[model samples]
Target: MNARLSGDEKRGGACGTDNAGLTTSTGPRPRRRPPVPEESHLLKNAAIALAAAGTLLLASCGSSTAPSGGGRSVVDAAPCARSTAPEAQGMPSTERIFGWIEDLVGIGYRRTGTLEGEKAAAYVKCQFESLGLQDVHYETAKSWNWSATRSRLKVNGEAVDSFPVAHTYVTLDQPSVFSTGPDGLTAEIVDVGAGVPLQSVQGKIVMFDLKFLMPPALLALQIEFLWDPGLTTLEPTLVIGNPFVTSYATAVERAMEGGAVGFIGVLSDYFDSNKYYNEFYRRTQVTIPGVWVTKKEGARIRQMMGGGNRSANLVMEGFRKEATGRAVVGFLPGKSKDTIMVQSHHDSVFYGAVEDGSGTAAVLAQAQYYASQPAESRQKTMMFATFDTHFSGYQVHREFVRKYVIDKETPYNIVANVTLEHIGKQGIKGADDQLEITDKPELRAIIENMGPTLKLGMINSVIRHDLRRTALISGHVLCPIGALPTDAGFICAAGVPTASLIAGPNYLYDAADTLDKVAKDDLVPVTKVFIDLIDAIDATPTALIGLPLKSPLYESGAQD
Candidate 1:
């Protein structure tokens, strides 16, 4: 679904593809490049260009000698050769990394606790084992499975299309089901534009618009002042402009407190579509029943209730049962007990090709690369984990943290974490001001909470690989405590220094997130960035990973 800009001045031009196949503005010109077959990875010729310089060992290289741990050897030949940069070597190809994404996309609808979600977990496990990763197994966590069998909404005797807002429950007698009863619910409709300062909603169904906050380019300029990767050329649109909602969960709570029997949310900012999976899975409690409708449907309902008190009948039938969310875990133990975790989530509400299939593929690529190396060469043990339960409220993530990071009896000591998520194309304004996916890679950010040593590694890697429009922003700057932007956020909060690569494409939760949405061009480049980051963390003393008071890359007067 496309996004409609709200109350913000539009900059840049309508999105169009230039002769080079890169994103070009129809109104104003910037630059363009050739298509993939004609063009190559940005770093493709680094080895050739730097032939005069000494070659470095590429982690993706194959070794006949198996790893020290009870691990098998990876048989596939390496796709990339040695690089000029020492820590950044042996890059994986877009085909190799994206192949893993294609495998996950083939298993459709990987929502948490569903059969397809389990299939995705199985696939990740198989990939781990096939990549010669050790201790490849499933770690289970308590979770719930929910599905809406039937949902219907009628306003003033006219039936309107609707879908049950994800994770919302009804006052059912049985513990396993959430339904509006056999007769359904009928009540007067109350319009609360944005659900603030709730009034006159008691005993009625509250209808409100769900507002999303789009990060404007000006905000990106401010973030750059705090910390920029020193990019010679920057695309402000690609500077992490993902839209987010700060109040949908709070609005539900307010409506329930105001005695609203049920609620209806209008996806006002989203493109004309009701199949949105937004606000589907957060850790908040949702006792009051709610549903979502597109903006077009919402306008009609509002018009019907404009003058007199109109009635609405809502019916939603579904079952919420006990289920288990599992995380696929594999290991490569080094000489020391200190561990570095490479992770991403496996479950998603839709096809999730970019929402997480891309991240999961990165985990597999890193695991394959590291597994190909000898265990003796590793400075710290590596744990490759693709977590489940991201949609079911991150149960598996919290469980992993509790067991490994917090629990005293746990075997491994995780010192640092490298997480990958959402490597995809940027969204731009098109005809009719609708949001459209462009050929350019989505704005990417490395939300990191680390010391100068490792942070410098992050900057150098991003710049070295030419990962354009990327920032090394601090995690706390984006989200406060308990709300970091990445799944591995808990690790950072737990004092384990982390670098999480994430982008917020507007269609992240929509059905449009298909295989094509995956940022194919940046696949290898992203992996190379994290590989270099891990190596930098490994070289740093564990105590110094998160010890710096100020960023070395920060200019004295950079901030205004």
Candidate 2:
């Protein structure tokens, strides 16, 4: 979920320079790193570093031991009312929240650094202004803008449906993995299956299988940790789509090192469709040119390959340049200086009705609710934000963390964060091997890094709202990233207690994530739960809110 690339040199170039230069009725704004050879190498280094650090931290830590960056202990801080359930008096209605989703999805594919992305940011800013929120502005960061204008794969001069792999650096102006002009790359095709072939494939096109870790297989390994609140049948409903999980990136690296001119991926576990828009590339300087094909199409291509010697033409044309990444921000003043930030990203690969359209709606709902109340009613100020660059990279996220939370650049102090994402239906690979989306709400988690009191409050809120199939999962439990896996994961690691509600569905990154994908029925309930959570946090003292260093789920050192 994190964008690994750093733009230290190119950052702040367009921090306040909006392409449209349209000022809000109110007004203005504000604003990385090493060069890695390949994305695979970069990811390997990151994984090793994170894993080693986690092991070391877990080895010396106990279950009750809090991390170094945490606030005062429960013994020293004032306690909050834990037995009572929060009221949803001012929460937005389901129609109001879902309407935001419809409006966002209407502005097709808001990929970061594009005109559509800017439009999305503008829309969020307008929402904040409509609520009369103060200091509505755009916080910008640099992004490596890449968009595929056209991509094609032809076998024996016949066209085969294909989509360019997200963020693969393919251009004619630079020294990328496969640099071709309008003629494109014409070469012999070789099938490498799931393994990285050792045979010389110099100047040839490599075709390899890309596997996704099925939810069923993942549940078989970690079923004990999975908690369902008696919502529905607990079946495998999501797939681990990270290419790194299945070593697809490694295969691409090996192919590149083996002198392959280009590559084609057979989506072995995809839902019999090819319009896959995976953003796991993390904006690394990857130069490989690749496209994804469906399982059925892959089978046909394999059959064609068996006939005789054949050549294929791979054409992928896209623009890669420096672009601005924005984060729309505003604040609601309260009696206290402590701030509880409500956040979600506005950028998406496709329609993203659930990937984050639902999340943006959640943020809007919270903002609308809070702003409607008098300032004296709120104990802590609320910061409402919808970030960009989620799909491109996390540069904007990092920038916000640096300038706002870590640096305390603003007058308000951010004591906690609540992030919402992917409120959608449960999806699974059906009996016929097709993607089946169910009507029930997705089994989700409120990944939290809070103390005992706050944790109990979250559990109570979930139950009170009848948010079935949802659990209060510890943020530190078996997560590859040190904190929660949601957008608030980074902030949680920064030691501000965070509760991020999220779910993983099969169509999260695909064009199939339409308006119908959002769990419209649960919109009001989900918003109410967060409303209860924020009220609980505001009531509790900051000192007792966080648990910086908690033990992993297993003593064996795999963190959640």
Candidate 3:
């Protein structure tokens, strides 16, 4: 039966792509290009270009090989040996995708707009160059950044381990063992559990178990579910109420408003939520020296100063500055002036092996697949981009539109968009890293370690980027209409056609999103469907590629 979708479904759930052509072992053999004067010129220019980009290359040719992710060159790049001659039927390879994973996540945590982020972008550029893509270059823009240099906490004259919350602002010097810097004052600890009182914690360090409030619409949905007990299916939305994703900044603001010297975040899920988790956000003016601790740590501090006046020291030195971030883009000319733009953000919060490294690897796989195919197979020009500033406000995507799409800066009319994110790792829904056992014996027997299923969005783009072709094709296979606007909203808002495939994993913004969290063998199914979608987009006519744009809810000319 075809999946019947309503407007209520939001983000993720299990679905099927088990159809003909989704997994065909054989495909049409591509035609090769005859060597000619133009081909000779192109080959010569490509060699010259690769020679010039040696300084920007990932590493030297003679670099020693190391184990996967252990800091050795995985493979020598074929930058100067791209042939226009057609290869066999090309598709994304899972093994090579994992190699790309080891390549990026092996580097380290790559927060947006940082030096590490720039280095990651450079690697992406090199990968594109190795794939024989032309016009591979870095598109850079200056953006604000945030970092936590040091944070210390002491209880009852004893030092305790602590970490600063990401994206929160702080500048407190260690004045004394019991008192913080110029901003903090001597006072007893306040155990304000998830509730903030503006006047109660004055001159005190307010440590609360960070509270998570679901966005209003999702809240109502859950209430309705309880009201109607027989309602079997859930709305396909990302509705988990986690404070790290939805509450960290708001709680900090409330604490600062209450005139607290420093703020402490007691992790809501001490068993699961790692204390090293970062609250990734844009730079905001209303920031306070904020640190997070486990629930056990909170309990220890509460016991230390029971019903008596005692002071504890808190120091936070956060790094904030404007830095240049780089985005890599490469072009493969096709049969038409129209374009298909495919992208994924490479910047990560921690090791980011999964939150985005998986997505980045998927993009690399797609690039390699496309490069291996004959250029004549493409009906539209293809632009592959690895973006930065994902943990930020997606400023890079916004800027790319303003300068190139809306500015009429380029000749290619980008008719479609294909975006990929977080397609690795089946979620183990318990604290001890165990699979959630169901009450029904039958269900448990058949369950396996499967990565979180992909959520394919079947929406027309509202803005500058067009990703509709890939999405429309997926609709015929497994695309559903309930995908939330986590990433595509920016492009869709611009009236572009877009297709997005993502796995809304719980550890998306946490340090626990390490390489190990990524699924080793689950990428094949997702890639198989992805290749089919690309073919569909290439064959579909432009007139039917996207839905007619719906009228805006409010006029842009009107002020708020």
lDDT for position 524 in model 3: 54
For candidate 1, list the clashing residue pairs, or say none.
20-33
Q: Per-residue CA lDDT of candidate 1, range 306-416, in tens?
A: 869589999888977767888889999998888999999988777678979899989987986787788889888999999878776677776787678766356789888
Top candidate by lDDT: 2
How many residue pairs clash in each candidate at the backbone level? 1, 9, 24
The order of the candidates by TM-score, greatest first, is 1, 2, 3
Residue by residue across 82-113, what tens digits does model 2's lDDT show?
11111222566676577677656655567886
lDDT of 3 by residue, 1-560 (tens): 24552211100001000011011111111111111222333344444344234323313421111112334332222232232222212554455566566556644456665545655665676567656678877677665567655677776677766787766553332111222354433455666777665465667777878654542234242121121122321422234443334556666667777777777777654344434555344434435566778766776777777847457777766576665666789988899877777778888876677768787877877787887778998997888888877765566766775555555577877666677777544333464533332221110000001111212211212111222112122221111121223444344444446666554455566656655566655555445555655666666666655642312411251101
Off by over 4 Å in 2: 1-89, 170-179, 214-233, 238-246, 308-310, 477-483, 549-560
Model 2 backbone overlap count = 9
Q: Can you give the lDDT of residue 129 in candidate 2?
A: 60
lDDT, residue 306, model 1: 82
Per-prediction TM-score, please?
0.77, 0.77, 0.68
TM-score for model 1?
0.77
